[model samples]
Target: MTHSTRSSHPRRRTTPRHPVSPRGLRTLRATWERQAAEAGGPGGFHHLHGPHTHGWLLADAVPELLEPIVHADDDPLEPTFFAHLDAPVAEALLARFAPAHLVHRSNGSPTLGNQLRATVAHPGEITLHGFVLGPGRCDERLVSEGALVRFEADLLVTEHHAPGCECELLWAYAVDELGLDDAEHAPHRIHRIHRAEAPDETWWRLLWA
Candidate 1:
């Protein structure tokens, strides 16, 4: 999952933190090592942002690429849903959000770089992608989920959720990211139908077979 390099980890908190086992930590570290190797080998450590950025550092990128879709109120590709994005960016976002429904959230915020961030994930991928569309350079990275949790803990994050099949939300986030372009690239027809909900008690009475 790719997200913004900026710090905005406090945006969502519904998912609570669970203890990390010693074995889990070791496994996570191994995953991180592999990620670092993919990024030209871990040449020591570097500080990107925050205090913990000094270990096995990975670059970052804008978070909106995937976060806004799942977090959208309804249709992930709805123009209004991504109004915050520029014309070009919005168009790209729509292309990615195809095969979506209009079920939207009462509240949605586009504050990836400025004040918030979005976590983009995909199934079968060990690294999480992150980016920041705010000021400074465009930072992006593919980092290990285990290492990210360890780094997050160092930042004193009271709650943490490691990315894996065990966590439904994280799993969905990953799958959604991976499948963003699935609807557009499929071999068969992809249908998206819209239906209005019953307005009142008598609304259902008008239904007919």
Candidate 2:
């Protein structure tokens, strides 16, 4: 008679029903950890720009995970200015997810609609997808899944808006102070801004304004 021994290891389970891709999750998690390690004082936010989407990601103590808040219906340019201005929907969105954990993304051209959309969707996941797969493919997936709808007019939207909106200020800073022609270059320019020893008062005003 021979005795047989059984292995004690258990098989790992997979979640096929997860809404976001594994790559996206990993990218987001890694980004969060990196930002957390690099951040000083309270953890702050980081910005991302994908071919089809752009938005902010925050690092904080408590992690809050939620579905990517899709804003496919709203006008990415005009409505965004008012959305942050005492709007109930915006308030509710913030209340659900702390600004640190929220992910926001929008559709439009890199210069106009998309930039403004990312700007307003703050305090902001399609952003994660964009980072993982690059902008073009991410946009295709979102569009096929009905998470985004295309608007030709988004390209025509202007950068300048109401004074309190901050869009104009951002545009001015990027163009004037940073001397960047394209909004797509903001991340690189931001690094330069960070490395500067004495970035002047205008830099502060445009950034925090």
Candidate that would win on lDDT: 2
Give the runs in model 1 whose Cα sits over 4 Å from its true position.
1-10, 22-25, 34-182, 187-209
Tens digits of per-residue lDDT for model 2, 19-70: 4435534443344334334432243322344333222223111112222332
Worst 10 residues of 2 by lDDT: 143-152
In every candidate, how many clashes are there?
Answer: 29, 4
Q: List, residue by residue over 16-69, the lDDT tens digit for candidate 1.
A: 222343553333223333433433334433236532221122222123342332
Q: Global lDDT for candidate 2?
A: 0.26
- Residue pairs clashing, model 2: 51-135, 102-124, 103-124, 104-124
Runs of candidate 2 exceeding 4 Å displacement:
1-20, 23-25, 41-92, 98-209
Supply candidate 2's per-residue lDDT for 122.
Answer: 35
